[model samples]
Target: MTSTENEAHRRDGADPGHRHLFHVPPADGGRYPESAYLAGNSLGLQPRATRTELLADLDAWSRLGVEGHLEAERPWLPYHGLLTAPAARLVGARPSETVVMNSLTVNLHLLMVSFYRPAGERTRIVIEDTAFPSDSYAVRSQARFHGLDPDTTVVRLRPRDGEENLRTEDVTAFLAAEGHTVALVLLGGVNYLTGELLDIPAITAAGRAAGAVVGWDLAHAAGNVPLSLHDWDVDFAAWCSYKYLNSGPGALAGVFVHERHHGDTGLPRFEGWWSTAADTRFEMTPVSRPPATVEAWQISNPPIFAMGPVRTSLELFDAVGMPALRDRSLRLTGYLERLLDEVTADRPLTVVTPRDPARRGCQLSVRIGTGNANELTKRLRHEHGVIADAREPDIVRFAPVPLYSTYHDCWRVADALAATVEATS
Candidate 1:
C-alpha cells in the first residue's frame, strides 16, 4: 500500500486530475499546473454526468407541467421513495425506515423531538466536544426547548493528553458511566476534523445498555463508509445527501427511525400532511394518522428537483458499491500515509487520523509544528497545485476519495508536500 510499491505512480509527479474521478480545482495553465487535489472530504468534485441529469429534469419539468408528479418514470409523488432503497442500502438500513427530507440540522431536530425524551434524572445528552458546529447548535437548542440548561444537560467528551483523537474505550466508558442520566447519545459517525471513524455499532450497543436512546449524525460517514444502522439497532440517524452521496449542495437530507419505534405511539412526533398515512392522504381527512414507517417524519411535499442528482449519484454508488470503494479508499490513503511518513521523517509533522482502516475513512489530518500550517497549505496550493484544506492553527486535512481518486493522486500530493517543505525551509 506504500508509495514505493507503485513506482510510476510516485515517480511520475503528475497532476491529480489525471487520477481523479472528475475535475480538479481548474488551473489556467498559469501556476502550479501540477497541483495534487485531496479535498474531496470537504466538498466532492461534481460528477461529469450531473449536468446531463439535471438538464433532463429541467426538460421534463418544462414539458410535463403538473402531470410530471404522477406520470414521469419516477413520479414526483414517490420520488422520495425512489431514493429510499438505494439510500437505505448505502447506509445499511431497511427501505421502509428511511426518508429523504429536510436538511441535516432540521432532520436532527425532528429526530431529537421524537427520541430525546427526558424523564426524572435521565435528562442529559452525550455528544463529542468537537462535533460540527451545526450539530452543537442543534443539541443546545434541543436542550433549551426541553427547558434544560445545555451546560448541565450536554456532556462534552474530549481526547486524552498527547492524543489528538478519541479512543473507542473512552467513548464506551463515557456511555457506561453517564448513560443513566443521558436522554440520548448523539455522535458524528465520522469526525469532520480528524477523519476519525467512531465505533457506531458498539457505541449504539453501549448507549442502549445505559438505557438511553441512540442516534447518529452520519453526515461524514454515509457514502464514505459502510453503515448497518438497522442491524446495529441504532434508534435513529440523520445525514446530508450532498457530500459523498453527490446529490449537490443543499440537497435534501435523509433520516432513519428504527421500525421498533414505528408503533411506539407513546413517542411524540411533530407531524404534518405528508406524514399522514397514504391511504387517506388525498382524502383530505381531518384526522391525522401517520404512515407506519419513517415516512411519518415528513412534514411537507418532497423536493422533486433534488431527487434527480440523488438518483444519479445513487446509481453511480450502486454501480461501484461501498465495499469496492472502501477498499480503494484504504489503499489510496495508506499509500499517502507511507509517503507522508517518509517526507516528514525529520520534520515535526504527524498524521492525526487513525492508522487502522477499521477506525477511519479516506481523510488524513496532518499536524505541523514550528510552522504556519495554513500558510504552508496555501503555498502548496498556489505553488504546487496540491488542493488540501487547513484547520486553524496547525492541521491540514487531505482526502483521496475512492470512486474517483487513484493511487497516483496520493503520491502527487505527497511530492507536493516534500517540495513545499523544501521551499519553506
Candidate 2:
C-alpha cells in the first residue's frame, strides 16, 4: 500500500469508530470488500439493531393486534415517548421542549403555524438562497397561505459575490438591518448544498432581537453536529431522522419548541386528539386539554412502525453521545479535507465547503469545475466503489459519517477521484 493508504489504515487502527454496529454496503466495483459509504449526509446506513427492534415491534402488532397498543414490548400507545428524551438529549433540549412526530417539512409547517405570524409591516420570512428546495417551497407556500406575495414576502439570503459559504456576520447584519420586515427567520442549521454550519445561536439571537421568531430546519444538522437548541434560545426547530440520525428513509421527524412557549394558548396550533395531554387523550372530552409540552404540536397518533427505527437509532446515539461523535467527525472530515486538498491540487475541483472546522460539519461539498457532477459521481461509485451524492450542476457532497465511516473510507474517495478524474495540471 502507498504511504497515504497505509496512513489511513494506521489511523483506523488507532481510532476505529462504531462501524460494526451498522451495515456497510458491499462494493459494487473495486477490490475493496466494502463500499466507502460516505453518503451518510444523504441517507445513513441502517443500524444492525434497527432491524431487530423493528421486527420486535412488528411481532407485537402481529400477535396482539389492537392490544399491542397497551401490551407490546415497547407499548405502541406511548411508543413515541420513548424517543423524546433521547432526541431531546441529542439536540441539547429538555424532554418538554422536544417531540418526534411527522416528517421534517410537516413538522416545520406545524411549527410555523404557531410561530410564523406575519403582522403589520413585518411580513417577510428570511431563508438562505441555497436552502433545500423543500424549505424554500414550504416557506414560500407559508407566505402564500397568509395572502402575501411570496416573491416579496420571502427573502433569500446569499453568500457574497465571490464566496461559497455565507458568513455569520453577513446574516446577523442582514437581520440587524432588514429584520424588521421579517416575521420569521427560518434557516437550515447546516446548508445542504455547501455543507456549511451556520451560526445558529448568533443568528437566532439576532433574529429574536429584531422582533422576528427564529426557527431552524436542522435536517442536515441533527446527529451530524452538537446542538444546544434550547440553550440557543431558538423559537423552534425541526429535523429529519433519515440522514445522519441513521433512521430509514422518510422517517418521522423531531421538533423543538422552546420551553418558554410551552403553555402559550394564544399561540396558534392546529390541534387534534393526539395533541391533548397523554393522560386525558382517551378521556373523550368534548374539549382538548393540550399539555404545556412540545407534544402539544403533535396532530395524529404516531405510526408505531415508523417510530421504531427512529427509537432504535436514537438509542444508538444516546449510547454514543454527540460530543464524542462530533470530535470524531472533526478528525474524520479534516482527514478527508487534507486528502481532497492533495487530489484537487491537480484536478479541476475545488472544495466549496468552508475549510474551518468550526464553520462546517462532517460533510465537504466539492464544486466540480469541468464535468457533470452526476456523471462524475457515477464514475466514483460504479468504478471505485466510492458512494457520494451530487447536486445537479456541479456540487458533490461527501460526508464521512463519524459513527460507521472509517479513515480508509475517506482514503478510497481521494483514490477514486485521483484515478477517475485526470489531473488537469
Candidate 3:
C-alpha cells in the first residue's frame, strides 16, 4: 500500500468505529473483501442484533398468539413505549413529546393537520427549493387540500444566484419580511441532496417570531447530527429510521410535538383508537379521549413488527450517544473531505456540500461536471466496490457513517475516483 493508504489504515487503528457490530456487504469488484460502504445517507447497514431480536418477537407471535400482546417478553401492547424514551433521548425530547409511529411523510402530514393552519392572508407554506421530492409533494398536496392554488400557496426559498447552499441569513431574512403570509415553515434539518445542515434553532426561532409554525423534516439529520428539537423550540419534527438510524428499509418513523403544543384542545388533529389514551383504549368508548402528549397525533396502532427494528436501532443510539458519534463523524468526514479535495483538484468534480463541518453532517456530495451521475455511480460500484448514492443527473453522495465507516473507506473513495476519472490536461 502507498504511504497515504497506510496512513488511512493507521487512523482506523486509532479510531476504530463500531464496524464489527454490523454486517458490511462483500465487494462485487476491487481487491478488498468488503465494499467501501459509504451510502448511509441512503440506507444503513443492518445491525447484527436486529435479526436475533426480531426473531424473538416472531417466536412470541408463534408461541403465544393473541396472548403475546400482553405476555411476550417485550409485550406488544406496550411495546411502542419501549421505543419512546430512547427515541426521545435520540432527538433530545421528552417522552411525552415523542412518539414512534407511521412513516416520515405520514408523520409530517399528521403533524401538519394540527400545525398547518393556513387562513386568510397567511395561507402560504414555506419550504426550501431543493427539498426532497416527497416533502415537496406533501406540501403541495396540503395546499390543494386547503382549496388553495398550490402554485400560489407554496413558497420555495432558493439559494442566491451562483451559490450551491442556502444561507441561514437569507432564510431568516425571507421569513422576517414575508413570514406574515407564511402560515407554516417546513424545512429539512439536513438537506437530502446537498448535505447542508441548516441552522435549525435559528430558523425555528425566526419562524415562530414571525407568527409562523416551524416544523422540520429531519430524515437526514436525526441520527446523523446532534439535535435538540425541544430545546430548539421547534413546533414539530419527524424523521425516518432506515438511514443513519440503522433500521431496516421502510422502518417506522419518530415524531416530536413540543410540550407547549400538547393539551391545546383548540388545535385540530385526526384521531383514531391509538390516538386515545392507552388506559382508556380498551374502554371501547365511542368518543376518543386523546392524551395531551404527542401520541394524540398517532392515527392508528403501529405495526408491531415494523416497530421492532426502530426500537432495536434506537437502543443502539442510546448505548453509544450522539455526542460521541458526532465527534467521530467530524473526524471521519473531515478526513474524507481532505482526500476528496485531492482527487477533485484535477478531476471534473466538485464537493457541493459546505466546507464548514458545522454546516453539514457526515455526508459529502460531489457534483459531477461531465458525466451522468447514475452511470458514474454504477461504475464506481461495479469496478471499485465503492458503494455510494447517486441523485440523477449530477450529484453523487458519500456518507462516511460514523457507526461503521472507516478512514480507509474514505481513502478508498478518493483512490477509486482517481483511478476512474481522467485528470484534465
Candidate 4:
C-alpha cells in the first residue's frame, strides 16, 4: 500500500484489507479470489457474524418455539429494543426517538400518515425531481388519497438549468418561496443516483421555518454518513439497513420521530398491536393507547430473522463508531476519485457525484460518456472481476464502503475501468 493508504488504514485503527470478516463471493466463475465489490450503496457486504447470529435466532425458534417470545436467549419480545440505542447513535437520535421497524418505504408512508397533514391552501408536498421512484410513488399516492392531484399538489425541486446537483441555497430558497403551500417537505438525505449528500440540517431548518413538516428518506445516508436528526429538529426520517449498515439484502429498516411529536397523541397515525405501550400491549384494552415514541408507528411485531443481521452489523458499527468510519470513508472515496481521474484522463468521463467530500459519501458516480457504460460495467464484472452498478444512460456508481473495502480494491476498480473503456472505445 502507498504511504497515504497506510496512513488512512492506521488512522481508523481498523483494516478492511483483511477481507475475511466478510463473505465475499468469487467472481468470474470462481477464477478470482473475490470481486471488487463496490456496490455497498445498493447492497452492503454480508458480515461474517450474520450466520452465527441468524442461527442463534433460528435455534431459539426451534428449541423454544412459542416460548421464544419470553424464554429465548435474546427474548424476541424486546429484541427490537436491542438495536434501538445503537441505531439511534448512528443517526444522532435519542433511543426513544428512534425504532427499528418495517421496510424503508413502509416507514416513510407511516411517518407521512402522521406528518403530512394538508389543510386550506397548504395541500402541497415538496420532494426532489430525482427522488427514488418509490418515494415519488408514495407522495403521488398520498396526494391522490387526500383527494388532490399530484401535478398540482406536488412540488419537485431541481438543480439550476445547467447544474447537476441541487445547491443548499437553491433548496432553502425554494422552501422559503413555496413553504406556505407545502404541507410536507420530504427528500432523500443523499441522492441515490448522483451520490450527492444533501444538506439535511439546512433544508430541514428551512422547511420548518416555512411552517412545513420536514422529513427525509435516509436510505442512502443513515449508516453511510453522520446525521443529527434530533439535533437538526427533523420531524421524521426513515432508512433501510441493507446498505451501509452491512445488513443482509432486504433486511428490516428504521424510523426516527422527534420527541416533541411523540407526546402529541393528536397526530393521526395507523396504529397496531405493536404500536401500543409494550406493558399494556397484551391487555387488549378497549381504547387504543399508543406509546409516545417512534414505536407507535410500527404496524406489527418485530421480525427476528430479518433483524438478526441488523443486530450483528450494529454491534460492529458501535465498536468502530461512525466518526472513525466516516473519516476513513472520505479518504477512501477521495483516493478512488483520484485514481479514476488518473486512469480516465484521456477519456471523456465525468464524475457526476460532488467532488467535495462534504457533499458526498462513499460513492463516486461516474458518467462514462462512451455510450456503453452498461457494456463496460458488464465487462468489468465478467472479465476483470470488478463489480460496480450501472444506472440508465451512462452512469456507473462505485461505493467503497469503509467497513470491508480496501485501498487495493479502489486501485483494482480504476485499473479495470480503464481497461474496459479502452476495450469498448
Candidate 5:
C-alpha cells in the first residue's frame, strides 16, 4: 500500500541500538581478557557446559566402577557410539559411515593402512605444496612402508606464480593428466595456512575418475564448514575435535569411511581389543571383525573423561545449527576485514584468504609484508592481549569461532592489529 520509495526506505529489523547476538564489547573500553582467544583453529575455547559433562562422567565412574560400561546415563560401553550420529551430521556423513575414536594422525596412519594399498605403477601419492607438515611426514612414511621412495612417489600440487592458494582445476587436472600413476589424493579440506577451502565434491569426483582414492584432513575445516562426505563419495577423512568443535586440547578425533568400504572384512587395519567384534570382544578372541560403522578403527578403549568435553561441544552445535552459525561467522569476519582496511588504509598488508565467502570459513590469514610476524604476535599478546597465531615467515592467522566469538571481538582484533602495525612500523 505504500510508495516504493517509502517501502524501500523502511528497514525490516532496524533498531538503531541493535547488537549482534554474540556481541559483548570490552567492558573497560579496553581489551577484555577473552579478546586474545583467537586460536580456535589450533584449539577451541572450553564451553561452560564442559565442566558439568565431565562431572557427570566422574560421578558415573565412581558409582558404577566396572559396571559403568553399561550403567551410566551415557553408558561407557556405547558412549563412543552416541557421538557417531552427531559427528556424522556435523561432517555431512551417514550415521553408519562415521565414528569418533582415535586422534587425528593416528587415524590418518590407520586409514592409510587400510586404504593406501598401492600396486604396480599406480603407487604415487598426490599432495598440496603447502600441506601441513605432519601430513607430509605421514604420507612419506606410508610410501616408505610400501617400498616406494617418497621423493619419487609423492606428487605435490602447486599454486600458480605469486599465488598463495590452490586452484581446484589445477588439482583435478593434475589428477587427470597423471591419473595413471596416482594411488591416493590426500589434501586438507581447507588449506591450513591460507584458509582456502577446496571444492570437495569436484575434487573427489576428479580423483575417483582418475582411479585414485581421495581422503581429506579436516583438522581446520571439520566443524568450521559444512561437509558432505557421504554425498560427495569421499573414500575417507579425518579431523581433530579440539579446534572448531571445541572439545578441549588433544581430544578424541573423528573419522569417516564410505559405506562401501565397511563390508570388506579382510581389509587391513592396525587392530586391538576395542576394534574386535563387540559380541565376542570380551571373549578376547584372536578374530577381529570391525564394527559396521567406522568405529572398527578404534585400537584401544576410549578415554571417557577426555570424551566428556567433546560431548558438550557437539551439544552446542545441536543447539545452534551450522547454517545459523556460519551466517554469523561470515558477517563477523567481514566486519573485521572492513575495519582492518579502515585502520590500515592501503598498508602493505594483503589478505591471502579468498575474498569469496564460499572459499573460507571463520579465518582471515593476513600477510604482513616482509617483516617479522612472530614478534608481532608476541607483542600483540603482551601489550594488547590480542591472541592470534603467526605462521612461519610472515602470515598471522586469526580465526573467530562463531559459537563463542562476537562482532566486538572481531572489531577488537582489527583495532589492535592497526595499532600494532603502526607502532611496529
Candidate 6:
C-alpha cells in the first residue's frame, strides 16, 4: 500500500472486515489481482451475503413450491414488507411511506401519475438542465400525456454561464419566479453526471410555497449519503437498488410517498390487485380499495427472486447504518480528491464534481482539458488495472464506495491515472 493509503487507514480507523463484506471481482480473467473497482456510481459490488441469501431463497422455492409464498424462510407473500423498515431507514422515511417494488423509471411514472397533476394554466414541470436522460424522457412523456407540449412546458435550471454546478440560490430564485406556473418540480437528489447534491429541502420548501408538488429522483443519493426525506417534507421519491445499494444489476427499486398522501381516495393513481388491502387482495373485488400506505402504489406482486439481493444488501446496510457509512464516505471521497490533486499535478485535468462534502456524494467526475478522456480511461483500465467509467466527450467518473472500497484502492486509481496521462501525453 502507498504511504497515502496507509495514512488514510490510520487516520480514518477503517475496519479491516469492511472489505470482506463484498465480493470484489478479479481483474485480467483472474490472472492478476483485483483492480481498483471504482464504479459504484453505475453498479455496486455484490455483497458477499447475497449469494448465500439467494441460494437459501432458491432452496425454499425448490422445496416448498407455491407454499414458499407463506412457508419459506423469508416468506414470498409479504416479501416486500421485509425490506420496508430498513429501506425507509436508508432514505429517512417512515415505514408507512415506503415500498420496495418495480424498477426506477417505472416507479417514477407510477408516482407521477398521482403527483404530477398539471391543471389550468399551471401545466409545466421543472428539472435540471443536465438531468439523466431517462428522467428527462419520463418527464417529457408525462407532459405529453397531459396534453401539454414538452418544449415550452418543461422548464430547466441551468448553471450560470461559467459555473459547473447549479447554485441553491438560483434554484430557489427560479422556483420563486415560476414555481406557481410549475405543476411539478422534479430533480435528482444527487445529479448523475456532475455529482452535485442539490438542496432538496430548500427547493422542496420553495416549490411547496408556490403550490407545486415536488419529488426527488434519488438514483445516485440513496445509499451513498444520508437523507431525511421525511423531515425534509419531500412529497415523494424513487431510487434504484443496483447503484450504491449493491442489490445486483437491474434489481427491484424503491418508492417513497409521504404518509400525508396515504389513503386519500381523491389521489389519482393506477392500481391493480396488489395495490389494495392485503386481506381483500385475493378477494377478486372489482373495486380497488387501495391501502392507507405507500404499498397502495404497487400494481403487482413482489418478485421473490429479484428481491433476494435487495434483502441481502439492505440487511448489510441495516447492520452498518447510514451515519457511520456517511462518515466513511466523506473521508473516502476526500481521499480520492487528494489523490486526484497529485494525479493531475502539472496536467490539465479538472474535477467537475463539487469540492464540498455537503454538495456532493462519493463520485468524483474528472475532465481532461487537453486529451481524449475515453482513450485515457481505456489505458487506465488496460494498462494499470484502474476501473473508472468514461462519459461522452470528456468525463471520467470514479466512485469509491464506502462499503467495499479502501484507501488503497483510491491510491491505486490515482497512481494509474497519473501514469496513463504521462503515457498518453
Total colliding residue pairs, candidate 6: 0
Write model 3 residue lDDT over 315-395, tens digit each, in one string.
889889999999999999999999998888878999999999999999999999975889888888998999999998889
lDDT of 2 by residue, 354-415 (tens): 99999999999998888589988998888888999999898899999999999999999988
Query: Which window of 10 residues has the lowest lDDT sum in candidate 2?
Result: 416-425
Order of candidate numbers by lDDT, starting with the best: 3, 2, 6, 4, 1, 5
Q: Which window of 10 residues has the lowest lDDT sum in candidate 5?
A: 11-20
Task: Give the lDDT of residue 199 in candidate 1.
Answer: 95
Show the lowest summed lDDT stretch of 10 residues, model 3.
416-425
The reply for model 4, stretches above 4 Å from the true place, is 1-18, 29-32
Which is the better candidate, 1 or 2, if ranked by lDDT? Answer: 2
TM-score of the candidate numbered 1?
0.93
Worst 10 residues of 6 by lDDT: 8-17
TM-score of 6: 0.96
The runs of at least 3 residues in candidate 3 whose Cα sits more than 4 Å from the true structure, single-residue gaps closed, are: 1-3, 423-425
Instruction: Tell me the whole-model lDDT of each prediction, alpha carbons only.
Output: 0.82, 0.93, 0.93, 0.87, 0.81, 0.89
- Candidate 6 lDDT score at position 313: 93
Model 5 earns a TM-score of 0.91
Pairs of residues at least 3 apart in sequence or in different chains that clash in candidate 3: none
lDDT tens digits, residue span 127-169, model 4: 9899999999999999999999989898888998977899999
Per-residue alpha-carbon lDDT of model 5 for 129-163, expressed as tens digits?
A: 89999999999999999999999999888899998
